[model samples]
Target: MENEMRSANTEPLHKPLGSSRTFPHFEGLLFSPVQLVKKSLADDVPVDIETKIGPHARRPLKLSMPIMISAMGYGVALSKSFSIALARGTAMAGTAFNTGQGPVLKEHRDNAKFMVVQYHGAFWRPTVHQLGQADMIEIRLGQGANAGAGTVVKVTDLPPDVLADFLATTHEMVDKPLKELVVPPGIPEIRTQSDLRQLIHHLRLAGHGVPIAVKLAASNYLETEMEMALRAGADVIVIDGAQAGTHGSPAILVDDFGLPTLAALCRADDYLRLNRRRDHVSLVVSGRIRTPGDMLKALALGADAVYIASAALFATAHKQVLKPLPFEPPTQIAWVNGTHASDFSIDEGADSLARFLTSSSEELKSGIRALGKRSLREVDRSDLVAWDSEVARITGLPLV
Candidate 1:
């Protein structure tokens, strides 16, 4: 009788699956808005969003604004055209563009004013000359999506020329579809803190005085990790939170790994302050930072700057995505080897992205002024108050 009653409560096997449950995201938290006195009375006065990263270094990296284009590799994640367009757009906006693990394209390097080259764990590491060309070097320890897991890509999926290049660089060949594939994972040499220190020393020399940054996924021991990175001589620390997106990461890794952006940012900040290195090493945060309000909130919470990837891609694709729509996801237009990849216009995409950055900076400046602050640096944690109890606790900010 109990079994019969339980069976009656179960849904039919033939019923279609419902929408997947929503995951916790940065959007769940709300930022306290500026409501009282204005910071700038002169509407003509432009807010100085210019920020200097790695100030203690011989050659510090500077930006016109606090926002930058995050790492998104060419061939692996996006096409050459998309990479070039983003580089051009970021250059126009006076911001930096990061070249992810994939081999760097000359077009992107030529177009971007400030290029941050990523040294990944993959076999596709760049040559010393290539590394020297970058304005900044980021040693990628891990990412928010698929933190420690390896990622595989089939050779057949790549174009003929791209496949040949990858083969030559990695000295790898495909015997069969499933048996042989391109896989990238954590750097084998960096199993200990001592190894990380050696890598930082090598990169510092290879980068030709350019700032060397260490990128790590936000996890429970992020503070401890940051300490090691700083001790290893990293000029900047990039914390990628759970809300961060990836082009082709596994669903399980994306959904289940890393700490949220709020928690990660607060913990890193607290650690830096405790060590009296708050002003020594710059902290850059990346996750699901969508709106200008989100960027402002992150900056106020102690982030020196913000790294934007998915948002930049969307801005670059802009109206171009419409061309591929009704048939595929918008990213299909941006992805390498996508059916519509060739259809994307670099000129149009670059223009759209530049406008997006400019407008977003303006909005952020408005928010800064609303808080009675003249500069982005003036907008600190004191100006912020969280509406959600969980967010308040996670960020260590006051509750509204």
Candidate 2:
């Protein structure tokens, strides 16, 4: 009877629909290795992993590694300790940490050697004075997890200190009751192309030559989006694909929206090359880029750099994840207001995360040597081949 019931209750997970299983992602594509004839003499010599974002800027954002800590905000998604730890860890790795749609905190800024501040639809928009503090400013247009949607967090779930900080930074509490904090779908002020251009101009002046980046979810019309961003005077374009993670988002949106990371990268790269804007605007890709191989592949496909959030969070929670055990998700340890949030040690987190970054970067350099390349710029489409026909067609790469 138990076996019969179990059989009856079983459901199709990979393909719940008639033919489609949500949207396709990076699982279908892979990097084809070349190990026969051409090989690097610098296998023993150190490879140059250093990267620059927004090369056209008077001063570009330089990173020791091509991988950067992606946005996971304080109060909104992560605890203050976790945020600071992430910042310090990336600083140790000589990369940047992004403040994801959260209010900029002094603790994060102090710890982060390079900071990417996200100007989101949330009420906590940074003031002109605060904008000047950022190494890079990202105008978040949409996210992979919830492409055209917004999120709401209740004030009741917030701690007193966090609530106080939020109130101090934003105008929501002054205008409305603190029952719930709402983030609108898009920046209400940015309605048209002219508005976008004007906002970018103002942000450029406020940031004092810091790179102004535009972050967008990977969509079918991504080429148009890239053109629009460039026209609006964006220095960098960040694309987060469907496989990207978020603290909380509707299941439908997460599963059904946006293009896969690989498709987005190839399409965007092709568009940039065609228009001769590839060098003028920096391209940064993210979403499910967990391994060093994925990072290297992205760079080869035309991404100047890659962003990592979920992987870094997992690295930070290396040992502490066990504290939650079978009862709760490991993420609870780093989550704000989580039961195990207090158990997360900032020192341990930073150390583990920095170590992970170092090891991953080493692995990337080794891969570059295998490809017979001295630097990242030398590693391009010729260094890569597709595993299957679909991938080959989409990427315009030779099939293995």
Candidate 3:
């Protein structure tokens, strides 16, 4: 069906949704549960699932669970109401929400408990006040979906209010209104390791001692990139694998570029361990990490935490999607420029997403207890075995 649609058109087939391509993920890796060898924790026993990012920084970004809402920009990826609902939902879950490559909305700040703002390659950068309000700062080097590709937003497609907000925060002077806004492939200011270090340092000062994170697309050069980020004094490293989703991107980049989440995590873990910096820097992995089991597998494979986007979006809409069913796509109610976006209920979306996070967190605790572990940090590669020989070789786990 997708191929037919592609063949029908000459222009690149753009999905208004995430990448549909499947990648080798954690499905082959199974948890080695304890029973006779090691007594499992009783159902009544407590488990600690709390996570801290950038523990070595002046102030770490703390979460009640190891799950976070990945960057979904407002006014570009999601409607204002949807963005605020995400903020409220993450706050309810006692987790963190990230502001993607869009202008920061004050409503998000007001509702969010912990907000991580992305310093993107766009001309409209976050202001000092916005940076100061962030719980953490993520330097967007690249993402899983588009890799280093830039973004183009047609002015006519955006809501008037959103367009106004973007123009207001733009760093460059515009004598006339722009027909389209273009986000460059990479930060124009950063061309070398020294440039990155300076930017991180400046962001640290602007963020008022908040943890500084460097987000990168998973690639073959993962170690070299990690080294550069480490030298730049990054407190946290976020790896978004090829399996990650996006609002929209070229099919070529989505299907062919970047490494799979499983491979990226292993390589990143090995690099950090080899340099003895694993304990000093926090590592967060994201790319098709939907279920609690996937989250557990990622943590076991050496990720300190995981991020979720499509799952969170679906959870937010949940049954509300039925409202647009049989007539228009569900995204019509959630997208920033969605036709039915105004009809989206913020309260309901927030409640649904909060419940999803809470439920996922509880399931994680159950998995931990089944492994005879009481803490998330206790589950490591030792607790995992690969069902596939190739997976075992990649993860260095015993093949079952």
Candidate 4:
């Protein structure tokens, strides 16, 4: 009876999942600029910085900054130049980059100081040897948007090797009877969370390698899911909210089904406390972590660092406007194979990131000061005042 009841409760997740709802009808909450400033001034208190995740893991990873870039899979979200520019930005910010759900670009490995590589699908393969190179490898169960859904990448979105693999998989899967085969439009692999976990365990067992991570979309049973992930040997966990950006999938999937980042992070933090193993794993939060304040709030709530990507893409694209006349996003193909350049000669892009990181860090420190704190580690969940929802729910902010 208990098993039956649990199964009944889990069914809603099978529905076509969409953007996060931890703060339901979130769009209704945003207002004009002046109100933003006025509301920003309302908070008052000293931030309580705390170590929300395991001290051993956090110390080794050393993720101190609140904002880290969410990995948008290569091709769909960024080109080589775009990624390199983002790497430059992350370096400026003293943060890490979550490698999007694609093969780890060697250039990205060299360009970024810290990274989390996510294994997205079967066709997106990386050998254990490849896994050894990562600071951490994240096995993605589902991103918030298009949960239970996978993407179809245009040839343009895939690099040569990924393209070859996708074509081979598609061809192999195509011969099967329609009843026995199901493939997503843009992605060639059919991934289940169970499959992801199996792979995660293998990576964790690889001696001396960085820890293995698993990324999941938040659902009502998130606590259970997290516990299971921990049990499955995940050293780090990423709770990507439905509000997280995706280049593919129906618009409906983008707006419904999953929890928002704010709520998901809060729930994951709570889950850690419940299991008494919050200290055993590192918690990284992604899904619209655009600013330092977002990172600060998440860290105080329990996340170690925020993942980012979209913002850096825009930054790089805009800066590219000043590149050599008639700039097209550059490509790197190997000798006689069209290898693209990773060299970022344009100081504009790198300089922009440097300035943005410095300014944002300062702004974060100001928020800290208002709350009567010093370092980022000092900020805590209590330092925030949720004006929107009541105590029982994600607070709806008072539109200033």
Each model's Cα RMSD:
5.8, 4.5, 1.2, 9.8
Candidate 3 Cα errors over 4 Å, as ranges:
3-10
User: What is the lDDT, from 0 to 100, of the residue 93 in candidate 2?
Assistant: 90
List the pairs of residues colliding in candidate 3. none
Stretches > 4 Å off in candidate 1? 1-40, 167-183
- Model 1: number of clashes? 1
lDDT of prediction 3: 0.91
TM values, all candidates: 0.90, 0.92, 0.98, 0.70
User: Which parts of model 4 are misplaced by more than 4 Å?
Assistant: 1-59, 156-198, 321-347, 390-392, 395-400
The model with the greatest TM-score is 3
- Against the true structure, candidate 3 reaches a TM-score of 0.98
Among residues 3 or more apart in sequence or in different chains, the pairs in candidate 1 whose N, CA or C atoms overlap within 3 Å are 39-372
Q: Where is model 2 more than 4 Å wrong at Cα? A: 1-36, 171-176
Q: Write the per-residue lDDT of candidate 1 for residues 236-355, one digit (tens) a residue.
A: 999998878776675556766788777888889989999899989999999888789889888988999999988888999999999888998788899887889999999999899999
> Best by lDDT, which number?
3
The CA lDDT at 391 in model 4 is: 26
Local distance difference test, per candidate?
0.80, 0.83, 0.91, 0.57
Clash totals, every prediction: 1, 0, 0, 30
